[model samples]
Structure formats: structure tokens, C-alpha cells
Target: MSTLYLLHKPYRMLSQFTDKQGRATLADVITVPDVYAAGRLDYDSEGLLLLSDDGELIHRISHPRHKQPKTYWVQVEGDISEAALKSLRQGITLKDGPTQPAKARQIAPPASAPRQPPIDPKRHPSTSWLELTISEGRNRQVRRMTAHVGFPTLRLIRTAIGPWQLDGLAPGEWRTETLHAPRPTDKHPNRRKAPRKDQRARPAAKHRKP
Candidate 1:
């Protein structure tokens, strides 16, 4: 039995327990010990971040190799056009690399409360909003990809990660639930296998071996 928490991390909150400058962290919001964040949302970003006591679950959720899809609502620094939307879906090249093709589309303004310090008002003329879903989690990837297409992200909120969603969680709030671990026979079990003992001990038996 593992303890799983769906936390809505507020803006300016650190993902980890400790900060050199004594900033806010999961410790301030969640009292549970030995629980670690599965993936990270930047301090300036908001939304669902999974926390758990099970190390294997953490690895499964956070590691890119697992291919968990994350969905985000991003407010960018310009009105998004169909051309921009197409570019995003096709994949955009960033300084790091070409982002994996993403599912992107225009979306109605989100229903969340207004940001405390609202996004820059001066940029309102240029800003627009979109929803993007990507299976890969790279450092600041969403912001970078949007910027690469000439729309710098003004605000970012992750709305979903795989099967979990932000749902009713409010900013700075957290809820714990029992997450059933996928069994060996479950769909998409980690499939890499170790080599057999004989296979490891013996050299290549092929006729073309050097």
C-alpha cells in the first residue's frame, strides 16, 4: 500500500522540501514525510504534481521512457493563429532540440481564479491561450516550444498527468488517495528483461562472429 497525493502546487512554491533561502515547499503544504514529488512543475507554474511514498511509482510516472502524457493550459504572449497551432502540432525546433509532436489547439479561457499578480497587462494585445498535450516532459519545454514559434508563454498550468487530473484541487491544496499499483499482468507493465545466464556467459554463436 502506497500513499499517493495529488497536489496543486501554487505559483512561487518550490517542488522539493528544502530550499537554501527557506522558500515555500511541499513541506509547507503537505505534512507527510518520506513522500517525494514524481515530476516537477516550475516554481512559477501551477497545477497537478503527484507525490508518493513508493519509489517505483515515482519512477514510472516521472521517467520519460514511460510515456505518460501531460496536458497543460498555457497563456502565451500573442494571439495564436491557425498557422501557429499547426506549427505546434507538427513540432517546433527549440534550442534544446525539436520538441516531440504535441497535441495543441485553441481553448476557451480557463475557469480558474484570476492570477494574484495577473499576467502582464501590457502584453494583453499580443497574448493568447492554448491547451497543449505532450508525452515527453522536458525542462521548460512547453514555454520554449511556444517561444520558438514566436509566442512566449505568459502563464503555464499543468491540468493533467496521465490518469490523474487537477480536478477540484485548489491552489496550494493537496489530497491523498490509494493508487493501485499495476500488477505484472496489467496493461503496459515495464517490459525490459535481463539476459539469461547462458546468454551472458557464451560469446556470439553466429557464423559471422569475429
Candidate 2:
């Protein structure tokens, strides 16, 4: 069995357990030993993060090759034009390359608690909320994509990762659950031959025969 935990990580907290600079880290919130974050949420961003002690499970969740979808609620510094939304859905070009098609749409402000240092309205007068889901995890991909569309992301929060969600979770809160599915097994290319009835090991001749 593996240990899995879902946490609502607050903004400005390091994803790892330690930071030499005395900054806040997961250790400050969770006390579980041997568990590590499956995927990372940047220190500047906040929301659902999965942790586990199982290496294979962690790879399944975090590896880009698996194509697990991650959903984020982003607040950008613009009114967010239709063209911009279309661009995101169609895939935005970044310095690395063109991104995969993403699911994006306008959304009302989330009902979550305000950020510790609330986004200063004076800094970004007009802002819009957008829900974007992407399968690929690039470094700062969401922020870069939004910026590519001419709307800088003011605040970003991941709400979902694959089948798990952050429902009812408050900042710095965590919950553990057993993995419902069986662990992944190695694939065998060649089929094994079954034993014939005569070849199979049979119970010793009945002693009753004597």
C-alpha cells in the first residue's frame, strides 16, 4: 500500500520540504514522513498538490509523458478578449514551442479566501478570471501562455489534477486516502504457455488405492 495526501498549498510556500533561506515549505504544513510532492506548484502560485511515498505513483501523476490534465483558475491583468481565449484554446506559441491545445473559458472569481496580500487592485485595474486546463507541465507554462496572449497572470491557482480535486480544502489543509486502483504492472510482450492437463502437477496418487 502507498501513502497519498492531497493538500491545498498556500501561495508563497515552497513545494519541497526544506529551504535554506528560512522560507515556508511543506514541512510547515504537513508532518508526514517519506511523502514527497508528485507535481509542483510554484511558490508564487497556490492550490491542489498531491504527495506520495510511492515512486511509481508519483511518476504517473507528475510525468508529462503520461499526459495527466491539470486545471487552473487564473486571474489575468486584462479584460480578456475573445481573441485571446481563442488563442489559448487553439494553442499559444511560447519560446520553447507551440503548446498543446488547452481548454479555456472565462469564469467568475473563485469563492476561496483572499490571498494573504490581496492582489492590489491599483496595480491591475481590470482583471478577468479564466479556467484553463492543460496536459503538459512546462516550467511556468500557464503564466507564459497567458502572457503570450497579452494578459499577464496576476494570480494562478490549480483546482484539479486528473481525477483528484481541491473541493472543500482550505489553505494549509491536507487529507490522506488509500489508492483505489491497483498498482501498475510491467507489460509482458510474450505470452506464457499453459501447462497441459498431464503436464500439470497432480496430487499424489490416492493413498486409498492401497
Candidate 3:
């Protein structure tokens, strides 16, 4: 059995258990014995964060090879244009390299709890909401992608990861569930089976009266 913790990581909190600078961290909200965060939300980003004692779960969520989809509701400065949305759908070229194409669409404001320190409206007098889903987890990839597309992200909130969602969770809150088995789509990694030998029974040679 695996122990998994679903946390609504508040903005400005580190995804780690502890921070030397005494800044906010997962330790402040969750008190489980040995669970660690799966992947991570940036220090300034907020929304669903998955934590677990299971290493396989952590790898599936964080490893880019799996191409697990992570979706975010991003608030960006200025009105997002169809062209910009199209670029995001195509892919962005960052300093590192070209990113995998993403699922990008403009969206109405999502209903959710406000950040502890809300993004200043004055700073972003004109803003638009967007739902972006990406499979690669480059560092600050969402922010970079949106910026490259001409709309600087003002506030970012992850809404879902693969089969998991931020639903029913609030900032600084957490819940636990014991997974008896992986979710259907998240079943164990596949491995080819070795070929089986013939299973047919041959008729015994009639008792040759030797």
C-alpha cells in the first residue's frame, strides 16, 4: 500500500519539507511521517501538489519521459491573443530548447481561494485567464512559455496533473488516501513478457509391449 498526500500548496511556499531561510514550506501544513512532494510547484506558484512515500508515484508524476500532463490556470498580463494561444499550442523555443507542444486555450476566471498575498490588480490592470496543459516540466516552464507567447503570466495555479486534480482542496490544506493500486491510466510500467513454451499435451505412445 502506498501513502499519498494531496496538498493545496499556498503561494510562496516551497514544495520541500524544510527551508533553511525559514520561508514557508510543506512542513508547515502536512505532518505525515515520511511523505515527500511529487514533482514540485514553484515557490511563487500555487495549487495542487502531490506528495507520497511511494517512489514509483513520484517518478510517474515528475519524470518527463512519462509525458504526464499537468494543467494550469494562468492569469497573464494584457489580453491573450489567438496568435499567442496558437504559438503556445505549437510550442515555445526557450534558452534550453524547443518545448513540447501544449494544449492552450483562453478561459474565464476560475473559482478558487485567493492567494495569501493576492497578485496586485494595479500591476496587471488588464489581464486574461488561460488554461494551459503541458507534458514537460521544465523549470518555470509555464511562466516562460506564456512570456514567449507575449502574455507575461501574472498568477499561475495548477488545476490538475494527469489523473489527479486540485478539486476539493484549499490553500494550506491537505488530505490523505491509501492507494491499493494505481489509477487505471497510471498502472504499473509495462514490460514485455517472455514467449511461453508449447502447452499442448501429446498423446502417450501406446504401451509398446516391450
Q: Pick the candidate with the highest lDDT.
A: 2
Task: Give the per-residue lDDT digits (tens) of candidate 2, residues 75-183.
Answer: 9998998899999999978999999999999999989868999999898889999999999999999999999999999999999998889997899988887886633
| 45: Cα error in model 2, Å | 0.4
* Model 1, span 99-128: residue lDDT tens: 888999999888875676887677576677
Better of 1 and 3 by lDDT: 3
User: Global lDDT of each model?
Assistant: 0.76, 0.81, 0.78
The per-prediction CA RMSD against the true structure, in angstroms, equals 13.1, 14.3, 15.9
Candidate 1 collision pairs: 78-126, 78-127
TM-score winner between candidates 1 and 3: 3
What value does the lDDT take at residue 50 in candidate 2?
A: 90
| Candidate 3 overall lDDT versus native | 0.78
In model 2, the worst 10-residue window by lDDT is: 201-210
For all candidates, what are the clash counts?
A: 2, 0, 0
Best by TM-score: 2
Worst 10 residues of 3 by lDDT: 192-201
